[model samples]
Target chain A: MTTVGEALSALCTPALVVDVDKVKRNAQMMIERCQKLGVQLRPHMKTHKTLECADIMTGGSRRCIVVSTLAEACFYADHGFDDILYAYSLPFDKVERCAALSERLDLFQVLLDHPQALEQLKKRPLRDGRRWHTEGVELTGIYAHCGNTYNCRGVEQIQAVAQETTSFTLQFMEKLKAAGITCKSSIGSTPSCSHPVKDMAQLSEVHPGNYTFYDVQQSVIGSCSLEDVAVRVLTRVIGHCPHRNQLLIDCGWTGLSLDGAGKLPTGYAMIEGHPNLKLLSMTQEHGRVEPISGPLDYSKYPLGSLLTLIPYHSCATAMMHPVYHVHSGGRLLGKWTPTRGW
Target chain B: MTTVGEALSALCTPALVVDVDKVKRNAQMMIERCQKLGVQLRPHMKTHKTLECADIMTGGSRRCIVVSTLAEACFYADHGFDDILYAYSLPFDKVERCAALSERLDLFQVLLDHPQALEQLKKRPLRDGRRWHTEGVELTGIYAHCGNTYNCRGVEQIQAVAQETTSFTLQFMEKLKAAGITCKSSIGSTPSCSHPVKDMAQLSEVHPGNYTFYDVQQSVIGSCSLEDVAVRVLTRVIGHCPHRNQLLIDCGWTGLSLDGAGKLPTGYAMIEGHPNLKLLSMTQEHGRVEPISGPLDYSKYPLGSLLTLIPYHSCATAMMHPVYHVHSGGRLLGKWTPTRGW
Candidate 1:
C-alpha cells in the first residue's frame, strides 16, 4: 500500500529502506573494479536476493551470478538469468533439483568439496543431452572464500588475505595444469573484493555480494566508509521508559536481526548521526535504545520521531524484511521483494 | 511444491517441520488449564502467525487472540478472527491503520503505555459512530508480561515470578477500583502461564504463546519438557570438514537464527539426538558443527544424512522460516505460511 513519491516518513516503522542511488553507485563501482582487474565479476545474490537488485548488481545482463541456495538458483533461472552458480558446498539432498537446473539453464554450475558429493552428482545425470561434466566428472574450477578477511581491521589486512588466497589459488591452478586438468579459478569475499590486490587480476572471476549494500561491519573493516552504506532500518521511537533510562523503538531482532552482537559499540546497530545512542537490546518486536555516556534527553526524541539505523550486517538485516522500500533522496521509488527459504 | 504424506527426509534441507499432534496437544493443554482457572485464554499469534496454527491455538473458535504486530492484526482480522488485542505499546505512526481496524473489526483492542499515545488515539475517533470510549476515554484494563520468568530455571521459580506478578496486578486492579475505574486485568508469559499461580484464576484473561511450538529455551526455563517441543529444523549434512574437525549443515543463522548465542552449550541450537555435537559458527548458508569434546567421527554422519535441530527459541526460529512444513509422526501434512512485516 506504500506508494511511490511519498516521503520515507510516511512508511511504517521498522521498514528496510534502500537508497537506490547508493546501490547503483556501489554496484557500478564493483563492476568497474572487476572490469579494470581483467576478471569476470560474478556477483553473489545472497546479500540481496530481489530480481531488481540482481539486475542492478549484474548491470542488467542477468548472467554469471552466484547463488547460495537452489531456491535462488531457480528463481533467477526462471527469470531469464543464465550462467548461474550454486556456490555453497553442494547439498546432497538437492541433487535432483540441481540436475533439473543443469538441464534447463545454459550454464548451471555447482560446487563440491568432497568426493561423496561428486558421486551424488554422478548418480543424477542431466537429461536432454545436457552434461554436468566432460568425461569423468570435470574439474569446473577452484573457488576459495577468503572469509578470514571478515576478522580484518582495515584494508591492509584485507588485501593481505586476498593476496594470500590469490597466490594459493594460482599455485593450485598450476598444479592442476601440470596434472592436465586445467580449469578456471575464482576467489572472493566482500573485504577482499572491495579492496582487491594486484594479484587478484590473475584470477578468472571474483564473486562478492555484500559490497552492493555496505554496512557498519564493512565500514569497520574498511571495505567502505559509513557514507557508502546503502540500507537503513527506518524505525520510530514508540515509548519512553524513563525508569529504565531507555527509549523503545519499533525495530527489534525481527527488524534488524541479532547480527554483529557484542561487536558494535552500540549494542545491535549504529544510530546514524547519533554516535552516543546505543541500541542496547531487542526482543521479538521491540528494541531498547539508550545513551552510551549520559542520561537521554527525552524532549529530543518525541513519540513517532524517525531514527535511522545503519545495520551491522546488511545481509542479515535484509533477510528479516520481506520487501525493501526503494528510495532515492528520501523519496519512495517502489518496492523490491526478495525470494526467501532454501 | 512439498505435498502431504511425504516423509520429512524426502523434503529438501533446511525445512522447518512442525509436529501437528504435539501442537494440538499443547494447545489443548493450555485451553484446559485456562478453562480450569476460569480465565479467558487469548492465545498470542506471534510465535506461529499461520491461520492453521491460530485455528489450533484458538480451539477453532477464531476469537480472542493477541498479536505482536499490526500486520498480524490485519491478517487475523481479514481471516474473520475477532476480539483481537495488539499487545504492543501503541505506535504513533500506525494509529490511522489501527483506527481502520478498530472500526472494521467486531472487537479490536490496542495497547498504549504513554499519555501521548492516548492523545494520538483521541485525535482519530472511530467512524460509523463506533466509540473507542464511552466517555472521556474509558479505562480498558491493565496488562503485564512477566518476561522475567524467562530467566527462571524451574517451575518453582517460574511460579514465584507468576505469583508476584499476579499479586502486583491484583493490587493495581484494587487501586483502579478504588479510583472508581473498574476494568479487566490480565497478565501472561509462556513460562508464567505454563505454571500459573492459583491467584491467576482471579484475573479476567491470560495470553500466552510459544507453548504450541515449545523450544529449547522454554524447555530450559521449565515451561515444557524436550518432548513437548513441537518444532524442529530439518537440515542435512552437506560436507565433512575433517581438517577443521567439523561437519557443515545447511542450517545457518538464516535457518535457525542467532537468538540463543552463548546461552546453550550446543552453540546456536540443540542438535537433537547428538548431545556431543556443537554448532560452533555459521556463514550465510552453512553451519559449522563439531563434536563438543573431541574429534568428530565423520563416518557416523555421511553427506546427505539428515540432522534434527531443536531451536533454542521457537519464536526466533519460526521467524526465519517462510513456510512451516506441518507433519504428524514424521509424515508431512501440509505447509503453513506465516505473515511477516510490521
Candidate 2:
C-alpha cells in the first residue's frame, strides 16, 4: 500500500527495499561481462523471483535464464519467458509439472545427476513430437556449479577456483569427445562468474544468480563491492532496552534471516553506516541491537527512528519477504511480489 | 494444488504437512487445561498465522486472541474476528494502523512499554467516541512474556519459571493497584503456560501460542512431548553423494529454517523415526544429510523416497512455507495459506 514517489520512511518497518538503479547496473554489468566472454548469461532467479527483477536480469529478452526451483520455472514460463534452465537436480515428484512446462515452452531444460532421475524424465515424455534435449535420453549439457568458490576470500582466490572448475569441465568435455559423445558445458557461482577466469570463455554458458543483488556475503567473497548490494531491510527502533543495553528494532529473524550468525563483527547483518552497532539477537518479531564498544547514546536512536540493515545473504533475506519495495534514489517506485513455494 | 484424499506421497517434496487430528487434540488439551485452571486462554497466533489454525486455536469463538504483528491483527479483524490484542511493544510507525483497527473492531488492544510510544498513541486519537482503553491514554493491561522459559529442560524447571513470572506479574499488578491504576494483567510463553503454577489463575488472562503446533524445541524444553508435535516437512532424497557419505534432500534452509543450529544432536532438524541421520548443512535448495556416527545407508533411501523431518522450531519452519498441507491419517485434506509481513 506504499504509494509511488513516497519516501522510504513512509513504509512500515521490517520492509525489504530494493535499489532499482543498483539492480539495473548489476544486471547490465553481468550481461556485458557474459557478452564479452561469448557465453550465455543464464541469470538465476532464486535471489529475486519477481517478474520485474527477472526482466531486468534477462535484459527484457526473457529467453535464457536459470531457476533454482520448479516454481520459478513455471512462474517465468507463464509470463512468456522461454528457454529456461531448472538448475537443480530434478526432483522425481515434479517431473510431471516439468514435462508440462517442457511441452508448453519452446525449451525447458532439467538437470539430472543420477540415472534414476533420467528414468523419471523418460517415463514422462514431451508431447507434440518434442524430444528431451534433441533426442530421447540425449545429454544436453554438463552443468557444474563452482560452489567451492564461495569459500574464497578475494578476486585471486575466486579466479583460481573458477579456473580450476573450467579446466575440470573442459577435461570432462574432452573425455566425452573421446567417447564420441559431444555436449555443451557450463560452470557457475556468483564469485566465479564475477571474477571469471580466461578458461571460462571456453565453456558454453555461465549461470550466476546472486550477482543481481549482491549482499554482504558476496562482497566479502569479492564478487561485488559493498556498494553493489541492492537490497536493504528497513526497520525502525521500537524500544530502548536500557536495562539490557540493547535497542529493540522491529526487524527480527522473520524479517532478516539467521543466515550469517557468528560470521560478522556485526551479528546477523551489517548496520548500514553504523559499524559500532551489532545486531545481538532476534526473536520472532524483534531484534536486539547494541554497540560493539561503549555505552549506546539512546538519544541518537530514539523511538521510531529508521535503521537500514545490509543483510549478509541477500538470497536468504529475500526469501523472508513476500514483497520487495522497489525504490530509486530513496523514493518508492512500486512493489515487486515474488512467487513462492515449490 | 494437491487433491484431497490423496496420499501424502502424491504431493510434492519439501511441503509442510500439518496433522489436523493432532492440531485438534492439542487445541482441546490446552482449552481443557485452561478451563480447569479457571483462567482465560488467549492463544497467540504468531506460530501459525492461518485463519484455519487461528480458528482451531481459538475454538471457533474468534475472540480473545493475541497476534505478534499488525498484519495478523488486520487479517483476523477483516475475517470477522475481534477482541484482538497486538501483543508487542507498540511500534511508533504502526500507530495509525492500530488506531484504524481500534476504530473498526469492537475491541482492539495495543501494547506499549515506553512513554514515547504512549505519546504516539496520544497523538492519534481514535475515531467516534472510542477512547484508548477506558479513557485517553489509559493503561489497558500489563503483559509480560517469560521467553527465558525456553531454556528449561523439565516440567519442574518450567513450573519454576512459570511461578517466578506469575509472582513477578502479580507483584507489578499490586504496585499499579497501590497507585490507583488497576488494570488487567497477563503473562505468557508456551513453556510457562504449558505448566502453569496455581498463582497464574490469579492473573486476569494467559496467552500461549506454540502449543498448537508443538515443535522439537518445545519438546526439548519440556513444554510438550515429541508425540504432541503436529507438523512435519516432507522432503525427498534426490541425490546420493557416495563420495561424501551423504544424501542430498530437496529441503534446504528455504524449506526448513536454520533456527535450531547446534541446539540438537541431529544438527538442524530431527529425522523422524531415524535418529542416526543428521541434517548437517543446507544451501538454497539442497540439504546435505548424513548419518550421525557412520556412513549413510543409501540403500534404505533410494531416489525420490520421502523423508519426514520434525522441525526444531515449527514457527521458524512454518514461516518459510507459503502453504501448509493439512492432512489426517496420512490423507490430504486441504491447504492452509498464511498471511505474511508486518
- Alpha-carbon RMSD to native, per candidate: 1.0, 1.1
Kindly state the number of residue pairs that clash in model 1.
0
Please provide, for model 1 over B126-238, each residue's C-alpha lDDT reduced to its tens digit, 9 standing for 90 to 100.
89989785346588888899999999999999999999999999999999889888999889899999998889998999999989999999999999999999999999998
Candidate 1 C-alpha lDDT tens digits along A93-145 = 78888888999899998888878787888888778888877448578898989
Task: Quote model 1's TM-score.
Answer: 0.99
RMSD of 1: 1.0
Docking class of 1: high
DockQ of each: 0.90, 0.91
- After superposition, which runs of candidate 2 have C-alpha atoms over 4 Å from their true positions? A134-137, B134-137
lDDT of 2 at B311: 97
True contacts kept of 1: 0.91
